[model samples]
Target: MKIQVSTELLDGCVLALLAEKDYYGYAITQRIQQTIPISESTLYPVLRRLHKESWLETYDESFKGRNRRYYRLTKAGTKQLGVIRNDWESYKHNIDWLLKGDNHG
Candidate 1:
């Protein structure tokens, strides 16, 4: 069964992607889909929220006569990504321990 992803996790994922390089909204969605099952529709709001929160900055570039908005991580976003990654590691460790019924993760 596929488990539903949380908003925080989604935000982290987006931040991680942008940490590598800037991406347009559609490209971000496609890159994320390679590892997680997420829809384009679902990602826009995350981008909007990040942009609104000042965690992300955007610039529009022309591509094939159309302008595509590209997202890049800000200093705040980098800091947030570090926090999320730490939380994820802790959460994953605990969950793995519970699932395996062992002390090791």
Candidate 2:
């Protein structure tokens, strides 16, 4: 049986946050929970991967004398969000039809 969340889910969460703000790792970790709750450990790797792939960009800021890495959507990331959001909508549409559950999603 297919189980566990997919990497696409990780990408979706990242795209959602990047669309919202330039967030530090900790802030991204927290904001992602609003929709897709995931652990700090799980998130760092995904964020790293996205940044490495050039889909996301990172910048630093001084907050209380500490430099923190922040993540934001690159042009690529913004472009990908449109594609991914369409895919997600189609997936949800089919799933909703089959399940007939509340459209809380």
Best by lDDT: 1
Model 2 Cα displacement at 34 (Å)?
2.6
TM-scores of the models, in the order given: 0.95, 0.86
Q: Which stretches of candidate 2 lie over 4 Å from their true place?
A: 1-4, 101-105
Cα lDDT of candidate 2 equals 0.85
Best model number under TM-score: 1
Give a tens-digit lDDT track for model 2, residues 43-63: 999999988878899889998
Model 2 TM-score, all chains together = 0.86
| Per-residue lDDT of model 1, residues 24-102, tens digit only | 9999999999989999999999999999999999999999999999999999999999999999999999999898889
Which regions of candidate 1 deviate over 4 angstroms? 103-105
- Per-residue lDDT value at 41 in model 2: 96
Candidate 2 clashes between residue pairs 3 or more apart in a chain or in different chains: none
